[model samples]
Target chain A: MLALIRSEWLKIRRSVIWLLLLVSPGLAGLIGLFGVREEQPGGPFPWLIALALMTALHAMLFLPLLTGVYAALVCRYEHAGGGWKQLLSLPVTRTRVYIVKFLFVMGLVALTQLLFLAVLLLIGTAKGGGGAIPWSELLGSVGRGWLACLPLAALQLAVSTAWSSFAAPLAVNVVFTIPNMLVANSADYAPYYPWVQPLLAMMPHQNGYDFGAFTLPSLTLLSVVMGSFVVFFLGGWAYFARKAV
Target chain B: MSLRILSAELLKIRRKFIWFLIFLGPIGVVGLQAVNFGLRYDYLVGKVYRDDLWGGLIENVTILMVPTLFIGLAILASMVAGIEHQTNSWKQTLALPVTRTQVFTGKFLLNLLLLLVSTTLVAAGTIVLGIVLGFGTGIPYGVLLKACYYPFLAIVPFIALQNWLSVTFQNQAFPLTVGIAGMVVSMFSIRFGDWFPWKWPYLINAAKEPLYSVACGLAFGLVVLAAGLAHFVRKDVK
Candidate 1:
């Protein structure tokens, strides 16, 4: 499995998709900085809104698409130049190959999230001028946001693998972008929908951070992650195993 | 030969990414807005951002800037037929009896249809959002319809550009990347407002009147579309 993953990683690196993936998050973060209103010489412009705006802007442009693109690229490698058939010709089981690819995509997602967090921290600290870093708040937001993306990442991977086209996964991402935004703002049933959890966890308040409104209970995150993992893995496995290649 | 070629072209489109956007994009937008309305009602209610808060809110929520939705469509449309060149599918497609004109038309029509469907979804999402936002009293149906029409008109140039890019580039990423980059640039450019016609998909919702004279934009769209078709018909797919 490790060898399979390593080979997949090598293929991704060779394809240049990995480099594209690494650069997009930072580019998106820089774009967010462009929209940031420099704190009016006196003080911050409502810290919560500023933070929320910063987080939401980056999340809106980069996070979901980044995850979708990463997932698609990983799955796309197998489809490129008939890489899947050649890989399957090896002694490894189909299930192991699927698992390894999925893990790799998820790992890439975590890395991007960390990159986003790092960018946010660097910007926030620099702008805040030696002020106490809101470490707990930032981590909380990052944790929740990253956790919320699991289901989406799973869905994107399933779609990309099943369709075997970059456009298909991209279309799926485009289609969901608005709906996900609206769903994230809903109060009644947002807790039930896994997609909204990340945005909900990042909501702002009057002072420092409104952790109360945005925090996702561990149980909910656990349930969502477990449910998505099972569904996504089984779905990918079933489609890849049964489909005529 | 023409029928076989056209059928093959259609099949490629069916397999393209644009289908997913056509089917699901607007539905997601509307559903998300409904949720946003439910949660942020307090903040939204009785709020006025200048004299046209209601209109402003409607525009902000309905605009394509929600998250790369419009740009994604533009990129997909621009690259749909072009991918054939990248994957060597065009060589196979051109080998059939069909003339280049037929193949180009088929792909253009398909791209147009996808764009239309996405626009319709955005329109529907906007209506649903208006109701959900508890501004049923404030939103004028005419304004919403007008706003929706603007995306269609504005997208004409984008569709044209996509067709042009696809034919010019053999690699699929070339067209897609260019289209995406164009959209990001437009976001900054349109902020100036005077360059609206060249903005290629005017941000109607954000405009003061939300409707403008799109004659120049329409002319540009037609010119580009005609030029793209002519180029495809004259150029060899190889």
Candidate 2:
């Protein structure tokens, strides 16, 4: 498992995915910085405002789509030229390999989340936010948003493993994810929908938006997040282990 | 020359999931509105008055569909290029009697055709969705036509750019990332002026004349297409 994880990390490090991951957050932060400035020059809850602006783009669409792309990139080399057979032929267990790849994708997503957090903080400070930094809100929203991406990574990995044409899983991801903006607003469906979890988790507190009203209670939110993580991770593992290379 | 290659390009996409994808773009966009209106029929309908309801429905669908169309076009371009990339047939196809320009033109036309089809589907689906929601069947023909098409015209530069990126990069993720970032920036650009290519799609319905955007899309799209094809012709295929 350790060896597989190391190899997976090596493969990703050599790719442009890391650099590309920064592009979305970097753009969001720039926009958010300008947004904070324009909204009354450090007005009420500037950190929350900056976060709202950041999450509005990042959590809603970029992160979900990026999750799919990262999973596909991690699996890209493996999906080519009997690469899976080559990897599985090693003494390493397929289950461990699958888990490790999934872990790497989650780790990449976490790095993106942390980068986004840094950008959010930087934007807040640069804009001279009026209030003391909302540490709990920042961490809770960013951290939970990252956590919400685990199930997506797992599901994307499963699809990536099954499809060799790199864009197939990605298109599928985009098709499913683009509706997050709408579905995340649904009072009845947002709580249970895995696709909308990141949006819900990343939403700023009392933002007076439709999404603000749609957030699940903490207990329900935790259950949904953890529950999806288990189901997708295990289901992906089972399919990968038995899938014909 | 162009027609033969166009048919060939279309044929290539058939064995792949490109058709399903072309259809998926509109279905996804219209389907979201279906659910949105289905759930909040009274609230949404109440928000808009009688005759204007049709325009409101088209407008609401257009707002959401812009991002969908942007992202969807990026995916379609990649998928079109990926068909050739996946098979390692680029060199083989290019080495044929057909010129690279013809091949590029065919691929570009195919992408345009797919976008047109998706746009048509969105227009049709919006009409269908509006009727089902009982928003009165008077269908604002002009608004509906513009809503369906203006974005497609406005998106030509982006389509050209994405096609270029996808065709050039063996790894599809780069173009996909660029497109996603474009979508993010485009969201913010709406507040800015209409100078940016990403902003063109939404700007078609701006308060000013819509032709300003349409003109930009045409001029810029051709320039980008020519530049991309030039590079594609010169670039060595592995």
Candidate 3:
């Protein structure tokens, strides 16, 4: 398994997809730096508002879309010229290969989260007051955002691996993710919807009326997120194992 | 030769569900509102944008539709070129008597035709949804027409760019990555000015003299189309 992961790492080491991953953080950082203003003198954690506002779209739409794009790009090389057949003929199980590749994609998504966090820290120190930053809230929000992306990456990887055409998975991702803007507004649907989870997890709801009986770290939300991750990851793994290629 | 190539291009996408995708773009945009009004029709109509309901609804749809149009153009362009790429038939197709210009032009014309159909659906969908929701009988036909078609006109340059990118690179990810990033930037470009081509769709709707943006899209699209053709003719198809 380690060797398989190492080989997969070599495949994505020097690809153009890394630069693509930076886009969301880069854009969010720029918007946060210039657009947000100083809070009132005695506010509690001014940086929280800036961080939340900046990451709203990044986590909601752009990051998940980036996940799909990267997953597709990672599988793109193998999909060409019957490479899948050649790869599967090797002395390894398809399940192991699928797991490694999925791990690599999650790693890339984690990198995006870290970069977004770093940019938020930078803005906090530079433009925001030299006051004490809410490191826990910031990291927790971004961490949960990454958690929200796990099922998405799994699903996107499955779709991308299933389709040889690079655009197919991407188009599907865009079509599904665009409506997050609407779904996140719905109290009834937002928590359970995979695409809207990141926004619900990241944004600090004011009324607290939406998630009645459930908080971000509530057992129910965790089970839902983890359950989705398990289902998609295992489902994709099963398909790859039984697939004709 | 041109007619034959155009017919072939059209035939290639048959049974591919590309038409479903074409109409799906507009329906998705209006469908979001369908849900919004369906759930909260009384609240929305009673509280928000009651004056000139048709204009308000159109404006709301356009806000989300710009990004959809931009992304849709990229996907359509990619799907067109992707057929040849997936089949490994680009070199074979170009080797025929048809000029490279005709091949590229055929794809462009098909994309334009699809987008026009999508725009019509959006216009028609908006009107239907408005009537269903009882937003009033006053329909601003001119505003609705402009809202639907003007963005299509303004998106011409992007259509050309996406096609060029898709045709030039065998990998569909490159063009798509560029298109998604362009969509994000265009959301912000509405603040900068009219110079950014990504924001042309929004500018056309928002500009004081909207004709200028429409003119920009038309002129820029023609220029890019010529440039893309010149590049395609000289490059080696692998």
lDDT of 2 by residue, A61-180 (tens): 889989999999989888767789999999999878888887888888988988998888777776665358889989998899988898889889989999998888998788778777
Candidate 2 backbone collisions, by pair: none
Assess the local accuracy of residue B89 in candidate 3 as a C-alpha lDDT between 0 and 100.
94
DockQ of 1: 0.26
Q: Residue A197 in candidate 1 has what lDDT?
A: 54
Candidate 1 vs candidate 2, DockQ winner: 2
In the range B1-238, model 3's lDDT, one tens digit per residue, is 7678878988999977688789888999999988877887777777787766787788878888888998888889998899999888999998888888899999999999889999899989999999988877789999989888888898899999999999998878778878887887787775565777877788544458777888899999999999998999899998
Write model 1 residue lDDT over A153-221, tens digit each, in one string: 777777877765556565666555545544454444556655555566555433544443344465775
- Best-to-worst DockQ order: 2, 3, 1
Compared with the true structure, what per-residue lDDT tens digits does model 3 show for residues A26-126?
98888887677665644543676687667665876778888888889779778888989887888889988888888888888899889998888887777
Candidates in descending lDDT order: 2, 3, 1
TM-score quality measure for candidate 2: 0.95
Better structure of 1 and 2 per TM-score: 2
* Model 3 misplacement above 4 A: A39-46, A128-131, A204-220, B136-138, B204-207
lDDT of 2: 0.84
Which candidate leads the pack in TM-score? 2
Steric clashes per prediction:
11, 0, 0
Off by over 4 Å in 2: A38-45, A129-131, A207-215, B204-207
